[model samples]
Target: MEVFSEYLIFSARYDVSMVTELDDSKPEIKAVTLDLWETLLLERDGANEQRNLIRCRNLARALSKFGVKISVDRLISVLKAMTPWLLTVWEKNREVTHLDQIRFIIKAATDGSVSLREEWLDELSSAYVSAIYELPPYLNPDAPQLLRWLKDHGKKIGLICNVGRTPGFILRRFLKDEGIGNFFDVMIFSDEAGIRKPHPEIFRMAARRLGVKPSEIIHVGDNLRSDVWGAKNAGFKAIHFSTRKGRDTIAESDPNSLISISRKLGGLKEEEIIPDRTITSLAMAIEGIEELER
Candidate 1:
């Protein structure tokens, strides 16, 4: 079966087609685990630049109260230099929490000479979280409908997302603000779990929370490494949501990124980590689920 939309076309040309055929007769998909960023939500255009500015300004403000004054330019430079360290942690399937990030920034900026009170750290983290409001991530046009469809069909739903910059707590609040929070039966964040995706443990954690075996759930996401590779390795059917708007572009552009590293670890073959199905939009997730139900 083919599913198409104005923004996407679904096909079964690769190993995904074979996986679909194999699972066609025994559809036990009782739940769906979704990736948060890019899968269900998108950062607005120019939001990244604006958010970075807000972060620098807020960090500066937070530091001022603690008798540490720094220019936003210096703060930005320190934060930019931390990206590789952050990526290194993620590559090891661990997440650096927002608190840890704040601590690192403070240490770097102060040259390890100053110690902040707990209250000050909280103030800084709050400021960082609030910056998201400048350009909040909005749901994909199809996310609400798809989520509702899954819930109405009696399928359990969960979110297994890798947190970056914005922590899982804030993302949960964002979900509630967008009016889709109640749809998930379980929500797991990499920072909170201490294990990022492409790691089987995180997927298994979601499965345990949902009271289903990994094989009984279908994991959907826009990342091939963390989403597809992780879920498949965990024994869950997987869907590669190949939306054009998300992190896929970054992976496509950089040959040495985490996703690239993951692809290499999967034997440098696309088919080795190919998802059970591929859809271009959230709107097509329902179709992929339906095909699996067949």
Candidate 2:
């Protein structure tokens, strides 16, 4: 009876140890979230400038028709003035609405000296949102294949993008027009989420919508603060996409813009925060994620 009792105790201890080991094992990766601007879509040097120009021209015409008689240069000046504010809000990881942006342009152009009638406000907002079609950003050469590969491997895909002059509706259309809209299982924009990346909550939101835990997801992007630091702080595995040359283009053509300053990895200490993997080529994305998995 004593020998039997000792054998029972050993079996119970072994079973508990096995269960604890399984519990501590890393969860399987169930989803991938990517940054849209630099990670998936590559913008040319002057696309943003051109898009704003188009908006100013369109708004000037609209204002003239509405008897407001605003000049394009006036509109340009207002936009330039707002750049600092935009950077300030973004640095705080806060977002402004598209309507508020349009209202600012009008408020600045009029110097609060003139007020447009109710109907004109709606007309002006449309002019602001529709500029992306006039001058569009191009897709990253390898983004489509990378997205497809993720889908084929049974990974849920998502996009967490920060919208600037161009808004989310237009960006969604651009994605569909570029033939990659159907690939994503989820899409989160700062304008819509009311919270931007590096906030941790936004990352958690994506994970919840993608039906996975944060630990079971990997995020890929070009920006260090917004993408890498954001994901890691939220308990996600991150892959830094550093290809600025060749086919794997990441971020805008110009990296010195003020907006880039707060988001990208310039003059920042890289010793404290680090990505689980870094891939220079989008083709090596699979390898990067696989390495993180192991």
Candidate 3:
């Protein structure tokens, strides 16, 4: 989750907003850009769970190539940081999975008493095993309700992720496992692209795949730099999903101040006919877009 706070400002804003619940009555998005990390599912802080888990898995796989052996506990430690957030995955599975179970798995895997087959040990050297075992899980169950809403509303959706180490394959697999794969018109992973957010090219690429000009699309993400700035630069409508409640107060404290803050944060200066509008929730975004047509 390195640089995650900066990456997920859009989600953070939405998290703060005490607005109408998520809805999709008059969806106008020719396409949608989703920021993977916090926007889709959040991993535990400090663990780099998603990436490290893949490294562990890959390292084990690579070691097997060299005839190295490994232990399950070691494999578990490598995968400890990864936890499945069923709520975020399944459209119908909104129930939260117990965190304790996740914790227990990690603790047990890291516990010193576990052992593995000698042949497995031979294939996986201690150095590789330790590195892999020390990695974490990609656990996040935020549910596919948002994705589902977009899909059901007849909008094309795509993923635009900014990740440090996690690969696009993992994200693809994760999304597919959550049953949201069918919703995306395209998926853009920074790792695979070699270019990250704030780069208009990435957003533009996704828009290209959807067969629409960026101007006709709406990008909903949790970042100011990558999501807001980049989307606007690419000529797409940008909406800030401020998730907080007191923002209305903040905005009201001095509408000018809010305007100033928004502009400085890569938002429109209240008077400027800018990238359409800003919203606090997916539900509001849907409504606002509809209102624009009215």
Candidate 4:
């Protein structure tokens, strides 16, 4: 009986060792894709609202210089009005350009009453973009380190981002200035791609751009629906960066914000949709991906 018990224990330990070896021998994941806001970039409580106000004031002042007078308060209203229209575009998996957004704001605010010359329009665009510099979102302290780790390990890195008031073009410049822009092999913005997350095509698009197969790529982001569901449905492995609460404002009253929040709030069973891995900090992403590969 003692000899039989010893044999059973030896076999069990040997099997576990073999399984671990086999798991480690699995093919390594080829690439990593990341979300922009709240993943790489950290948001402050009131930074966004303050930035929006600065934008409205900047544009209003620029208009005054061009001999077109519009109240800052009216500009604020026009800006808020864009939330619904912008949300509509996003819902359809389409994105509107920055220039179009600018045109919409001016047209909606003035009711076609004040048309600026082309040069004046150029000035207004600068005024709007400059607000970000004055009141900007800070980077995640873990971002640079993770990015470096991926590069060192020879993994192709890319960005799958959704832009709000700040457009893709501006974000590229911002990332470049932030000193980590060179890490990405490709960057796809919803605005430029004309598609949003939770839609599988966007993930596939990033894979194609990086010249990698979907199965060989892993994506990390904060939103479950947008990043996890989107990447997995599109055939890529995903890691849920649950450190950030979400991009939705807690008190947001915009119809779009409400609709987005409701989906998360409305879902009861948390496990109905699950990510391949969930990490509380970006630094753990390195080990998370390794585990996924295994």
Candidate 5:
């Protein structure tokens, strides 16, 4: 959690034939690297976001058709009430569960904000508005600043996303929506690769496409094995994005315990602690890399 500056020596030795490419004309993309999900597109960790709020709103709207006539303001109140329970659900499954049923139950629960029917309401609408809005480190919003900064230093950027079930389609949609699709030279997704991180092949695939030896590229991500060790072992510069949440409590605890907990949770690793560079915010990441070069 403590972002420390440590010098590291990286190994670079890649066998080329083992790497296959779909196209050789993509400028050997100067930097073929990335770890998607939390690294680039950050959805709200808890329930407080535009999409789920709207999801609740849409559910309420649909229930109106069923003669339940719930006002959006009242639905907003319901969403506010649901926010506390939202964390419980996230901590439980890391994904929203039974959304329609939950909202309908919320409308009906005496403990819920609006007490309507207790037993059963008709089926809620199938309008899932989960991916409505996206947060920052967006490809477009600050691109002129970020791209100008990254471009000035002659670093090419690409994505190396490790998705569990979400495919490249979702990733592309998010990027395209943000209007920053032009930034990445290549986009790699776990679903597309049929292999997940801690596996060397995926990294190899990225390096191959970039036409640069892995050693020349630096991979930035939130995960340790997928982003750090995987790239480190594959001979690329590995940088870890240690978040404040992971470190805030540790700021008070003994550093050893912090390191231990981080390791256990896959956030901290022995080699990871000593990244060639460490960054807390992507906005500052390019600056950090410049500082490292200095």
Candidate 6:
């Protein structure tokens, strides 16, 4: 096993070939923990772009009602500058609430010279949430099947998601709308939990809520550092759902985002982030879990 500051990666050899059946006799895992974005849900093509435009427009409109008068371009730029700070908070495994985000933007818009009323902040947050609601991301096609399979097989399922800008309350509503909310026995969102992944606390909390030991829970997620390293550190088995086929593609598409997030969060090497198993799609999760037990 390759050990990093916060986690250990077990080196194992197994056939990566697809398995078509689950060995009903080998049901050792008591629970399963899943990541939210990219694992069970994916934004529709160009959905992110559309959401950003809507967010900017709504935010600008909200500020206008407060007589703040910030242009959409300026709002976007202020938000972009706040990304690093947002990352910094996340790196600490801490969550920045939606209200706090709006406060920061308002501060930036006014060059640190203005303070908005509490009612105004609430208005901005609601507007932002409304925009997000208008363009909710759809779930991956295979997600419902996988989630149902696990639940029907008597495994306690939980969701561990990192949130920024959007709160956990909103996400729960989205899950219900998509018809998978009932599958999760427990849902832990960073904003609600006050800690984000790569943090052992978050993983441990999920295990606690599910009434299972960390060793008896398998965490499946797409991000190497956040999901794999975090779960491993908490003594849980992990499966990496490489949605883009491989790490190379992920790095190429968003070179700085994940790497920088990992670095700021501390204690993960590329090698240490390796998972016990890798699945290219969510449909493979069932077999992957069974294989791990074997």
Global lDDT scores for all candidate models: 0.82, 0.81, 0.55, 0.83, 0.55, 0.80
Candidate 3 lDDT, 113-151, residue by residue in tens:
433344544343332323323453342343366666667
Q: What is the TM-score ranking, best to worst?
A: 2, 1, 4, 6, 5, 3
Q: List candidate 1 stretches off by more than 4 Å.
A: 1-27, 250-268
Stretches of model 2 off by over 4 angstroms after superposition: 1-24, 245-258, 262-268
Writing each residue's lDDT as its tens digit, candidate 1 over 133-191 gives 76787888899999999999999999998887888899899898989998999999988
Candidate 4 achieves a global lDDT of 0.83
* Model 6 weakest lDDT span, ten residues long: 8-17
Count of residue pairs whose backbone atoms collide, per candidate = 0, 1, 34, 0, 2, 0
Model 4 lDDT tens row, 137-251: 8999999999999999999999999777788888999999999899999999988998878789999999999999998999998887778888989999999988535455432
Q: Candidate 3's error at 75, in angstroms?
A: 16
For model 2, residues 3-87, the per-residue Cα lDDT tens digits are 9999799887788678778987877999999998767887666666677889999989888887787899999889888877777
Question: Which of candidates 3 and 6 is the stronger one according to lDDT?
Answer: 6
Question: TM-score for every candidate vs. truth?
Answer: 0.85, 0.86, 0.51, 0.84, 0.52, 0.84
Off by over 4 Å in 4: 1-27, 115-117, 244-270
The alpha-carbon lDDT assigned to residue 155 of candidate 3 equals 79
Clashing pairs in 4: none
lDDT of 5 by residue, 142-181 (tens): 3345555666667777678754223466567767777666
Q: What TM-score would you give candidate 1 relative to the actual structure?
A: 0.85
TM-score of 4: 0.84
